[model samples]
Target: MKRPNFIVIMTDQQRWDHLGCYGNPVLRTPNIDAIAAAGQRLDRFYVANPICQPNRACLATGQLSTVNGCRQNGIPLSPGQVTYAEVLRAAGWRTALIGKAHFQNVTDVPAPSRQAAGKGDDLPASVALARREQRDGPDYLNEVRAAWAANPDRTVPLPYYGFEYLRLCIGHGDQVEGHYSRWLRDRCPEAVDLRGPDHALDDPAVRVAQCWQTALPEDCYPTAYVAEEAEAYLRSCRADEPFLLVLSFPDPHHPFTPPGRYWDLYDPAEVELPASFGDAVNRRNDLPDALRQAYRMGDEDPHSYWPFHLFEPELRRIIALNYGAITMVDDAVGRVMRTLSEVGLDDDTVVCFTSDHGDYMGDHGTVLKMGLHYQSVIRVPFLWRDTAQRRQPGVSRVQASAIDFAPTILQRAGLRVPVGMQGEDIFAAPPDRPVLIEDPGIGVFRDPDSRSALISLVHDDWRLSLLEGCMDWGELYDLGADPNETTNLWFDPEVAGRKTELLLRLAERQLALRDLSLCPTARA
Candidate 1:
């Protein structure tokens, strides 16, 4: 028997509801929908963190953020930590990561090198004066002001992860030029132009336009081209030797910029607003204002009231655009799947589809991913297709996490799960164990005073949430009754004993797993 080839397709900042199979009416993700139809779709799939780098690190190492020390986006995975790539490479499986890995560099910069140089010193003061000029107008002057205020010393080196084949963007999409800026400028000097008026650099659409004009066939837009390269690799592989391919797409993340055709794919009027769209729930309870402001969700001041409810129309438009981008990626998935079939490797390959985390997608008055644990951000779509004879193909509604994926992939490849992996072999185990999820107590942006941490134990009929740190709110939901989690039953004295029982179970499991970082505060 030959080892099954693994192809894991991960999209950035994508929500589960963006797929057609997940009951979304406007979005047409035919390829992913087909995968769900042919394979097993786990109904309750979640990520340990709602952010990018931490979740990606968890998926790669099969460990939680605290254990791997990749608790934030900018933090790098430790050099000593063993990754699935290292394990597979040692076992003779060819490994390749094509697209956004979000891996961080670990080099230390010297103090002298950090000091200011060139005319860059005057840039910030000039930009601040310009911002003050535009503060009373339609344009957002602060964006321009901040760009000028940025230090010229911040330089991120490449190949943060141990991938044999890699193509990645260091930070946000617009910042791609900064890392690849010199290379692109050198290659296409006439085509590339970064020197425009002060306002042009701040406009996301303008920056994207600059990138498209200067990019080559391979780098023109690495995300789409990488998919093509991965498909070719899949077509050329042999069945005797195993391989692990990570197809990470950076689309649907930011700038809301897609190819022209994709932008036209969906009608804005046809898109439906979310059920919790534009609701003024307690923003401080879930996420900080600074993080929300970073994604342009709210105002600057922590307590300043922003008209989030008024943005529903534009927010729905953004969601519709994001869905269009997802559909574009799905089309790429279809191309890859068809290539596998054409090369006669379809039945010999194990296909897994998921995301690093999920986008807010206008849920709870937020547009992108930053904070909050609503199903919109933490719950991602997980589907696995087992072509191996020993595996089953039926769908399971059991709760699963991203950490379970690495072990499952190793198990399918007949490789051993490392000793320190925090997740179990979800495929080998029975569907009866409760699924657990955790959120660290701090907000990435704004509202620093409203720190909160949550640990949830989910079973078939009930979900018990133990919250600590900032807010003393605990929630118990009958998932059978409140699938949307609209009602909280933690205050009900009648269910107090049941809450305590579930909390005990949660505590016991946390202790057994040695998840000490999630331990409750003294008050909790």
Candidate 2:
């Protein structure tokens, strides 16, 4: 019997409910839906954090942001950390990563957190170590677009974060540049003129922010490039060798540019706004100042990466374009899956589909993501299809986080999971534990008195979040009673007792997940 091959198809900024199988009535995702139909669909699967780099780092390391030290978007995953891909590669599996690998910072911008702080002796020793330590190397610049733009021939060093071969798409939407950019320029030199909002089709009807009708054809888009490369890799695979290939799509994220027919697959007029959209906009005064600022932004689309408020009509346009991008990704997925079957590796390969994080997508009147942990931003689709496992095919509401992905994949591949990985083998037993989400916010929360660092615990039907750097305000929600999170029960005295209990659990969970990989050889 041969070890099973792995194909992890990940999409950027896609929420759980955006898929047809996930109860999305508007999006046509027959291919992704087919994967769900044949596999176990995890209903409550959440990201370790709501941001990109941190959660992706958690996925690769099987550890939380605090343990892995990638607490925000600009922070690169430490080169010292071990990834499951490295484990599989070490075991003689041919490892390849195609499309978006955001393991490193995409831009050359310095993080605000790295700014010099005021001199303070009150800070703990751990904070001193973390703040002063230089854990990354010069290779950290491998993913920066400026570096690539300066030298198009440069590529990431081999075995990057465990991937032996990487076909990287550095940024999101059509503007993405990396190996994909070089390939696109070579394949179609004219594609350069067709990229970005400046070259968008003349469509005044769509007034959504960060959305443009790309002039590039469907085949020339990043999503199509990823599928084509993945197909080529599958075709090149030898029968005697097992491989792990990641088809990561940089679509369905920001600056929605679905090329060709994908741009108009869904009509913005027909798109439906989220249930909480109306309430959020109408009752902005009732929300915390931190959250209400989004609603006050009105019609202006700053086009900045941070979440911004949008009117119902503008949000509808975003949804429509987002749907178009998603459908394009679905088509690409269909192509890859068909290639798997064509190469006769369908039955032997484990196909898993998930996303790094999710977009706000009109949830609470916000468009992008940051400083918020609504289900719209945190919960994402997780589909697992393995032929060797006898696990019944059905929806598993058992909560799981991005950290669990690494351990689960390693266990399924019959590899020994590293002792340092904090996540459980979700397949061996239900991870009937609370999911912890950590986010060191990037100034998205505009409140001066509030610090943006957040720690949330999701268990059963209750969600509790503690906003660090400030003690006066926090969030507590009864997800069972209010799935839309319209009400924050943090101030409700009736739930005071329950909130205390959950806080204690959150503390215990945080301690439990601390890095125990380093054992002291000497007690002194």
Candidate 3:
């Protein structure tokens, strides 16, 4: 039998609640919604890290961010790291990456993490977050430009981490660069400039990074670029050759610039504030004093959003823009799905759509993301559309993460999984698996005393966040009772026993997650 083809469509900073299939009432994501309707959607899906590079690294290597060695945004996956692409290729799969890949450190001269991604004990939280070492690292645009000038038509950009072919796109929003920049220039040179400055949005109160419609034509948006490239790759695939393609989209992220009519898709008045934001979340506040202090800008605006003086109404507008961006992505997804059928590869392909992580998106009054372990930032959408699996279409409450992504894909392709892979097969995925989430915070916690390295565990109905040394101040949420995660129960006397039990559970879970056993024990 011919091995199955694979496609993993990933978006940046998209929340699980943003999709129509995910119980989102307002957003119309027909293509993605249909994909979920075809197979099983894991409802409790999450990422090991709430940020980009780390979890993307996990998906690439099938290991936790701490273990894979790219735990934070600035750190690059080690060159010695054996990504699943390499394994799948060795297992007789042709692979290509076509879009944003934060796998490499994105530097001309790569910086190897001395320790694995989030395993740096000697590093201070500020140091880890600040990325002081990368201050003078080669500018990404100049490096990509010079590299392309020197080596025209380089098959894979910077060896593409592990992909055999890459049409790499870097930068997000109107600030697009790399191969995508060139592609946009070719199609819509003016798109390279965008609708204009955020000030052009005409709302004096609107921040540059807040919701806005760009002057650039919708056809030339990055979402369109990725969709076109994915179809091109699908069309180019040989008739009998099996392939693995990762088309990562960098949108619904920030600089909330949706192109053309998508900008008008949602009205700001229709946007609703999350129940956990402001007084609502604070009324039953379980946020650690330290976490609260971190969020306390004290009359100053948090840099999470532009203009920073965000009121409830302004946040709603931002949410509306975020919805628009999701719609735009949905349209791109529709085009790619149509092309998959057009190329006659739809039936044999195993397609999964997810995101690097979820965005705050006005949840808890934040815009994008921080190291927070709230469902808004850590919980992402995971859908598997496998032609081989003929199960009743529905949502599975199984806890899933990017760690399982590679093994799941390889399993669908009928390829042997590497013994070193630390994820379960999706076909037999553990419904009660304790999903581990890691966040190597980007510089300075809300409280100066807090640890920068955060480890969160989503086991069953409880989500616990363990601070790297400050154990007492860590967060524990009874997600069963407060699914919105409005209350932090870390120091609550009522749950002291529960917290202790969870601590022990976390200890055991950590051992399981940290185990690097590459082979079964052989007794002679």
Candidate 4:
């Protein structure tokens, strides 16, 4: 039997409920919906961290953030970490990455020379800054690439953690950089730089609370660009060779900018806010004073946090734009799926779609995610389709996560699961393991504070969260009763027993999950 070709499609900051198939009443995501209809969509899928880099590192290496040392956004994956791409490549599978690849650090970025100089170099700030500004490499975010594009070595990265070839799109929104920027450079120059993280172009339609439409045509959007690249790869590759291609879309994230026609695809005035929107019950005044001070939630980031007291209308527009971004991604997926079928690679390929994490999407008056562990932020849509076999499509309520991806892909490819991996195989059928979600730090996991950490466990329809070293006022949710997570049962005496049981489980999981992959028998 031939190995199955794998294509994993991922979106940035898209919530589980944003899809038409996932009970999203407003959006039309037929391509993504079709994938679920044809394959198995996990009812309870999640991410180890709600942020980008850490979760991506988790997906790539099949290990938790702590194990890989990329606990938050700014920390880069250690070059020593082994990823599924390397394992598959070693097994004779060709691998490539398109669009966002947030596996590296964005702050205090190292130059190629400095990276080669090894970790302990104590260079002055000026020299290090100069070197990093000149470097590019495989930065997963466009902002990072643009910041370090001067270093010619960035174009020729030192080694990608595991991927053999990567065509990185480092920016989000109108801030498209790297190969994506070049694609738009002369082709659609007018729309390319309409807006960016630092500069906003003079377009009225492109202003929706960090959300906007660009002058770029729908076909030239980054979402579409990614599909084009992936399609080209599929057509160029030999049909007999197995390959791993990850098409990562960097939209539906912050700066809420969906380019071209997608910006107006959904009407903001007609868009309804989440059912739990503005429920003060979502507030975290319950946390310890220290944690509360550290993560002010709605008070931290002004761009993403628009108070109804002054900007209720803005939030609605953002939601519409968020959905618009998702819709565009859906269309892109549909395009690629068609290309796969056109090239006759559909039957031999396995397709999996998911997000790095979920977004708040205006739930409880929040636009994006942070330290909150509500279902809106923790639960993500995970769907898989194996076209090689024909079966009734179904939804599996398995407790799984981004970490499980690498192991599953390896399993699907018939490659040996590496001993160094900590993620579970997707088909192993482990019994009732609680989903563990960790928030490694403040800002750049980018939160409001750097002094706190959050860990959550979801098991048996209950979710429990604790602040590291501070437990007086952590959060507990009876997801069965309050599916919207409108109520936090932390102090409710009626649920004390439930809380105790979950706490014990969380502790046990923590003790068990700490890096323990060393093979003693193989050692002398």
Provide backbone clash counts, one per model. Answer: 4, 0, 7, 11
Comparison by TM-score, 1 against 4, better one: 4
* Per-residue accuracy of model 2 over 1-524 as CA lDDT, tens digit each: 68889999999999789999999878899999999888999999999999888899999999988888887776689878999999999998999999888888888765433322577555665574445655455778888877765566776789888999889888888888888878887888898788888877857465467888888888888898999999999999976899999999998999888888887789888887888886653244544554444434433445767777778777887899899999989989999999999998888889999999998888877788875688999999999988645435788878899999999999988888897899987776565689999987644433222355778999878899977555787889899999998888998999999999999999998888988767688977
- Candidate 3 per-residue lDDT, tens place, 1-524, comes to 76788888999889888899988878889999999999889888888777777888888878887777666666666656678788777776788887788765454644344342454367654566443443333322332434643443444434455577778776566555557766776787555345445424456454534445577777887788889998888889875888889988878877778877877788878876777767344213564543444344421455343213256877877778788888888888898889999888888888889998887766666666764678888889988887654435788887888888888877766777776778878668768878888776533323233356778888869988876656557778999899888777877899998888877888887888874745457864
Q: Candidate 2 vs candidate 4: which has greater TM-score? A: 2
lDDT of each: 0.63, 0.83, 0.73, 0.76
Name the best candidate (by lDDT). 2
Segments of candidate 3 deviating more than 4 angstroms: 106-159, 195-209, 280-309, 388-392, 444-450, 515-524
TM for every model, in the order presented, reads 0.76, 0.93, 0.85, 0.87
Which stretches in model 4 have alpha-carbon errors above 4 Å?
Answer: 107-143, 148-154, 190-193, 197-207, 282-284, 294-300, 304-311, 390-392, 443-450, 519-524
Query: 45-147 in candidate 1: lDDT tens per residue?
Result: 8887667778888888888886777765445666556787778777888788766666543112211111233564445544434223311222211112123
| Model 3, global lDDT | 0.73
Cα lDDT tens digits for candidate 4, 1-524:
87788899999888898898898778889999999999988889989988888899899999898887778766677666789998988888888898888776544444223222357868776665433442234454333665543431346363366677777777677666666766766567564345564444335555555654455667777788899899898887678998889999988787777766677788878876777887755455655654444236446555543222114687778888888889989988998999899888898889999999887777777666675677888788998998667434898878887788899988878788888787787768584778888886443333323457888999999999887667577888888888888888899999899999999999898887888766588647
Least lDDT summed over 10 consecutive residues: which range in candidate 1? 106-115
In model 3, what lDDT does residue 111 have? Answer: 38
Order of models, best lDDT first? 2, 4, 3, 1
Worst 10 residues of 4 by lDDT: 302-311
Tell me the deviation in Å of residue 154 in model 2. Answer: 1.7
